[model samples]
Target: MPDFDFTALRRFPDVEADNLFAYDASDHLILDEAADDLHAAAPGEVVVIGDRYGALTLGALALHDAADIRTHQDSYTGELALQNNAAATGVTGFRSLDLGEELLTGSRVVLMQMPKSLSELDEVAETIARFADPSVTVFAGGRLKHMSIAMNEVLGRHFGDVRASLGRQKSRVIRARDPRPSAESAWPQRAYLDELGLWVVAHGAAFAGPKLDLGTRELLRHLDEMNPDARTAVDLGCGTGLLATALARTRPELAVLATDTSAAAVASTRATAEANEVAITVRRDDGLSQQPDACADLVLLNPPFHTGSTVHAGVALRLFEEAARVLKPGGELWTVYNSHLTYRPALYRIVGGTRQVSRTPKFTVTVSTAR
Candidate 1:
């Protein structure tokens, strides 16, 4: 049995905005060359990055009887696809990582699909360089439209020596031999929009790193009014650690757990935690991964409405339900969302109560809980 399938993805027209299902097809749009070849080579330990679905991951795992598979993905849907596909194929030896912590390196082979950000690529390069060595090989693959001659050069900078495979399915795989660790440079820094006349530092892979996002802005306004004495809190989708840092600053006594699914977001949040000199726990987590049931006093979120080019509410809905599961009785779950999302009814259904905290012309903030 194939470890994954994508028949369900056909119902949605847009790939970025809808509930995404794992697919066997490669559109050859965001391609990486190394990954194309690895479908055929079954090394025992395979690490995959930017696996949009469980496609490359489970395929590699199913190729061997006792295989080790690791994947780093940023979006909630991407992680969900990995699990759904893994369960479908019964391929179990897989590790799913978000944007930060350290990238798992030193695999017999590493597979990467091209991401949308250059800084992300650099971050992946730096993180993986820490864990790879001469014995490890990194295989990269991308669609011809997505790869350039410089693609191999970028791969060459870290892994040393690059060879390209003949194109198949309009996808070519690049073989990156000799995993020589690259020098640690200053982490990539970019600015993202925040409030008017204000922007924040975002490393690669944050949502709108050069500025504060619209949903996040809606989220930012609600933080100042939350109970200052709530002793335990969580920023469920703690992107770039901005909301978590602000929460820590405002509620000095509140123990806050910050998390995001993006490897880049995790790294940036870690840096943000260090820069603010606050003691917030930061991790690359799936939605509420490390959280315990009925424990959080407050869960703050600006749930994402889209994943990359796709727009949908699957992730936000998932987060809302997750918040419900993790909140203590009488604990509040707060979020800022697009007005068009009509998240209030769903909010009501999950937590049994919902109230609009505030709103902009384009967005609304709501507080819900099992009071």
Candidate 2:
């Protein structure tokens, strides 16, 4: 099969807008601004982040030799798109890693794709600051909506000196020159709930940040009731690993498999497991590709409905089908999604039975079982 290409969305002004095969010709912000800066960068061992759909990572990897440098990633889709685009483009040498993974302790340049969460960006900047200096040139791009005076403050706080390029096609790029080294914190460990108290593993990405989401909080409630007597169970789309953590907490006798598309999420779960001192299997997987057929007793999912600009049922539908494929007869999938999604019809077709267990104004939970 041909390598999957990422489809670009408008308004997420980013440094790697055009590197994607699915580039939006209509992209009018950071794409143009970042393109100009990238052309002038003398690349070697550069780390790129927030490359939504992976234009910047692809560019850095293809533009530089791996022996000279490496590119790291943390965005969920960014990793997926980066590997896909790399294979399709026949680009080699560069390996994709997550922020939750070890960061560039020796990277010379950092190319950042600003995220929607300014707090996240601040965290990234602080992480890089530990190793950044005047020798480290940080180049970043974003849309007008995100490019603000406040952003400059964050940049200044982490890196000493900064400048920006003129907006081209509504895009702007900031150049931060780090003169003095910034203090680095020990990587924060992921926290998992357990009898041991707190599980903490230093993860540098989006997975096990400070708090848990509401959907996962609700899903965690049913984990104790889940039949763990089966040989194996999987927590699909485990974010921050709260679901996986509960599974491990309740079923000390079973080896719980935890998986997610996000590298950070996977690492966080692993960290959570370690911090809680609970033993569970964790991996980065697209849906349940790594699972064996008829192997799981339960597949827990809080499936996301969209990726960037695309809002479709593709993710949820795939998880359901994959759950059925890997589930033994009578095995079930317990999942949650926004209440607005019409998932019942899709669930009925994928599983033998679909039951609505609970709902809120914004989200709903369903239990699907195979006959």
Highest TM-score scorer: 2
Evaluated at residue 251, the lDDT of candidate 2 is 73
Model 1, residue 190: displacement in angstroms? 7.3
Q: Which stretches of candidate 1 lie over 4 Å from their true place?
A: 1-19, 27-46, 61-71, 74-109, 125-203, 307-309
Question: Candidate 1, residues 1-371: lDDT per residue as tens digits?
Answer: 33333343231211333345444224232223434444544544567787777666665655433256667876654777667666665667778765443446445567777666666676676566667545556666666666678767666777767788777776766777776665665455745434433334566677667456777767777676775447889888787877887778767888989888776677777777666677898876677756778888888988888655356777678788788988888888888887877989999998868899887778898888665
TM-score of each candidate? 0.71, 0.79
CA lDDT of each candidate?
0.67, 0.65
The per-prediction tally of clashing pairs is: 36, 12
Least well predicted 10-residue stretch by lDDT in candidate 2: 8-17
lDDT of each residue in 1-371, candidate 2, tens digit only: 12323342222211232332334322323334344444544444466666665565554444333233355655444566666666666655556654532555656577776655555667677767765434666777776655677877877877778888777655677878764444555445444445334454534555336466677767766776665456678888776666676677777776789887766677777777776678888888767777888998888888877654445566577778888899888888888888888998888888778889889997788888876
lDDT of 2 at 109: 70
